[model samples]
Target: MGARRRVREVRPTDGPLLEVEDLRTYFETRRGLVKAVDGVSFELIAGRTLAIVGESGSGKTVLSRSVMGLLPQRNVTREGRVRFAGLDLVGAPEHELRELWGDQIAMVFQDPVTSLNPVVRIGRQITESLRHHVGMSRSEARAAATALLRSVGIAEPEQRLRWYPHQFSGGMCQRIVIASAIACGPQLLLADEPTTGLDVTVAAQILDLLQRLQHERQMSMILVSHDLGLVAGRSDDIIVMYAGKVVEKAPTATLLSDTRMPYTEALLRSAPRLTDGSHRRLPTIPGAPPDPSDYPAGCRFASRCAYAQPRCAEEEPPLRPGAVPEHTYACWYPVGTPHGAEALELNRAGGAVG
Candidate 1:
């Protein structure tokens, strides 16, 4: 008789702070169903950072919105599990989720000006969450708000708290947003390009502040950015998304030094490096990503992939570990390193995938 199949242990309790399992979000558009987030999955451990790197329309923003329960309910559909601190966010009750929202998790969006209310005082906005979530009295909330502003490196916190959103510069508004996000000391922080509109110098300062805060609070963060350099420097784990799916995920050093997936490699090659000398043409990915409504069957990147084979258009590959457990990629024909590496030698010297 054949041996009994091994039963995989179902241990949701042992999962990380947030575990996104086969999550998908679809939009019912007039043209057709747009699978904005198609079966993307990753885990964010406590006190660590996971950077979701992708180009625009790659479902990076949508995925973050779905987790935060911010999407419009009329035409949006979400599937699969988002287990956070043992609670299922996808189907959790609204009131309970609201209670958990600010204290357990909070978000700092890409654009601070758009996110902040122009008519409202910064102090009121910050204290509102404190009053609602922590049941603080108005005076106590105001005091806390002032402290938060100071904590995020805002000068003249007392005076700044009375000003409206529009009175502050873009960088100041972003700092206000960050201050409010950390008011309750949330265990999870979702920063979606939190430095998006700020100048380069200000952006660096903001990132430095965030990293310092994370270290002090030991908070888990999911940083969504289009900048590969940002991810390479800040994240412990890197997940590369293309056409609403994760093509590769690996430790930061491994992914940067020896990217396996073609899409990931292309993204790295296209990034501007300080080392690159003056050149007329910069390296770039050849084609645009597929339209969500009509993604190719086998590989979403096959159309743009430099090493596309007949099989690439015929079969989809499951995301699995590369060489070891922390490094994973989804491609039949991944790329190789410039110098000899294990993953590189495997792909270049042998016909392993065939």
Candidate 2:
């Protein structure tokens, strides 16, 4: 927003910054134990962007919260390891987790309205992290907060500092949220649907700003979104989740080119194409996602998959390696395979698939 550019430098790690192994986050409810995140594992290398894509209620947000140790206590039970920077956060102390929250790891939540305090001044909120984590003096934190505001494309940083969240536009409020999140230069940034409640142009601007900031800060980012097309070119690696489990994972280019999971293919098919005419009818996925409290013994996507066989309804598919080195998918009859082809044909003949 201003002429000055202040990009905080973070030391890059040779290995993964965050390593999640068989992480399961379950909440005990009156209905039953809701398995929010079921045995998810992934490695996020420093300075790389990992996009977790899935439809709503797919546990993308829950997985991010679990990695950040942001889940609530009491009824929630978390199993498995969430290692960040070589330290396991699963059973870490509350004081230690609090320290890592705004310092080494920061999160940009979906709604900017909820991310910021309506009553607190913008400058104060941004400076709080710098003062608490960075041990900056009052004046130093104030100056740094101004610089942070500018870095996130907020103009008139000095004046805007006195303004409240409701005083700014939706996109501007999100920028302020980003400024606060990055004030301390966290090594890992978790942005969960950062573009929510914004127009298309503003959404693009927010995404581009995040990418630019990540590169400049040398920060490993987890970009959580429900749209595959949204994170297509923005992420280095992509993980497709369904019903609390990761169904497919691969490098961005490879996953799009050689997709093995039927669920992933269905998502791609349902997405609106850029070259399509304006009046074209949008394709929709049949059937709804499975309920978390009552998960199926079979494949999570079996009910909605057109290529699903009788075995799919009886057996759960394990996450296995694909033809490509980096690609992995959880599907018995994978896309482009003879079994999948025959299954799809059978479904079409019997009026099961559109």
Candidate 3:
């Protein structure tokens, strides 16, 4: 907390709040160049929740980090436009990014323990952004910090503010982190696997708190997670990513009702359903994701996809409009199509689908 200054209010814009176009984030590693995020593109409307759903190493985290400008400078290359509030973040100056980081945009990292300072008191951590970005005095910032904690459903927030990170449970610490992220009233919130490590009950509570806060603040959010079930109800739109690319994207209801990509179907099938009995074994994707350093020339999921066709290996499919206007997928033999049915039958008849 520091000297107080008047903070200006932000006006709403008509266009999408964030527009990522042909974004690619590659890392230089000993093995070779690892394309963690390649040619990804999407738009996030203001006050809406967009979910990026994929398995681990599917470039979900890397995509978030690229947008947040949190990737390491050395041994990394970022290409393409990350437009937010009409500003191109990819080409923006470092100082400009710093000014916007906690003020206009904030991120809730996966691990609260690593994200939070172990030695610093929770109050200081929360108030740091308030004072620096919001220009609140120490006392005012402290009061605001307490209110933030209280808003996140922390009881006795005033007393808890003085506690260290270790004093709180994992879920409580996550609440603290969320409080800090929303302290400055950011326009956008990027929550990367916010529910990781928490028990199912606690995870549900955290997601509910986030949804409530997003509604109250009218802030747009991008949730990055692997669990399709976790984001099914929470997100308005969902983007399914494979090895460094988006395989499917659609409105939540549309995606759930009619999934086109085989990878997306596999993910949905693998998820534990309430209808599943305790005696039933959970469904699983047969093979692992492709290595990023040496991805195949054609469709990345062709090897494991049950409805893959010979064309899937011979030629890469572009993300194209599906039967619906808002739904899109990158698969030559999409599910629910005649070609997909033939491919499935071929696989069943001991013939290679691709």
Candidate 4:
């Protein structure tokens, strides 16, 4: 339960469908200000899926919250620009954001229980957005809601419409959330770990539904999740974040085949596979993210990076474009290729590498 912050947006842009430049979000706590997202920047094209992958507490959720304008108005402070469709969102009026939220951009949460209202009928909850945002009448919204439920694969849509959140299974509830998110025919959808806490089959179904919807609607998506496999399968591009900053960003195929960042490589290695490889221990990046209030001066990940040198502790590296051109990593010594093997050998000798 964090308080939302009111801050000004800076740096508006054009060209890309969504552009985030030097975005910073800080929370006021008793200890100090928590700089959850500091100087993160990226772009998403229309109708393309950008998967944001990171470990827990890496500011993945915070960035999404900032984009959605969900942060509280109290002690939180936000700087930088979040421009979508040529409009700056940093200090956008609430009424303007409300008009866009359901019609232009929608969000699907990981947990269905908290997202849906218990007292309202599932039908009303899904249809309400259409009525408010699209100006659909009661009867029209209900019909549209029923069609949406069926489209999302919910069984017996008519009967289920009358039921409350308590009656549905986790998967069913998630489907309802998806239905609601799509009810307004939005152009951009922000799904925060949409498949978390569900059975593998159900999770796959949810992802499949999203892909189909995106294709049919020509919708763009910002998928926030830790599951590398899901991102690899569903996303066109991947953005790897660590300690409130992007370490690597590239096309998914490029990233999976040739990860240019040590952190991204570690994440790929840590993924569970069905293959049998004896004595090959699961790789893991050692140490947790530094407390935002007391982040290390140089690289936020320097304390855990295997390639860290004395300079790494003293100076932060700039995020530069990699060999592939579009792929970028923020490291003085980007991993992979000629220098990577020697680095891996050194790490093996010291037993500090993932």
Question: Candidate 3: lDDT of 153?
Answer: 95
Top candidate, metric lDDT: 3
lDDT at 43 for candidate 4? Answer: 92
Q: How many angstroms is residue 270 displaced in model 2 relative to the true structure, after the best TM-score fit? A: 1.2
User: What local lDDT does model 3 show for residue 305?
Assistant: 83
Q: Give TM per candidate.
A: 0.90, 0.95, 0.96, 0.93
Model 4, 259-291: lDDT tens per residue? 878878878887768794767778677887799
| lDDT per residue as tens, model 3, 1-354 | 334453544456788999999999999999999999999999999999999999999999999999988889899999999999888899788988888888889999999888999999999999999898777878899889988999999999999999999999999999999999999888999999999899999999999999999999999999999999999999999999999999999999999999899999999998778887876777677789999999997899998988876788989999999878889999998898898888899887865532
Task: Candidate 2: list runs displaced more than 4 Å.
Answer: 1-13
lDDT of 3: 0.91
In the predicted model 1, the residue pairs found to clash are: none
Please tell me which model should have the higher TM-score, number 1 or number 3. 3
Model 1 regions more than 4 Å off: 1-14, 337-354
What's every prediction's RMSD, in angstroms? 8.5, 3.3, 2.2, 5.6
The sequence of per-residue lDDT tens digits that candidate 2 reaches over residues 179-245 is 8998878889999999977999999999999999999999889999988999999999999999999
**lDDT for 314 (candidate 3):** 86
Best by TM-score: 3
User: After aligning candidate 4 to the native by TM-score, how far in Å is the CA of 353 from where it should be?
Assistant: 5.3
Flag regions of model 3 displaced more than 4 Å: 1-11, 351-354
Better of 3 and 4 by TM-score: 3
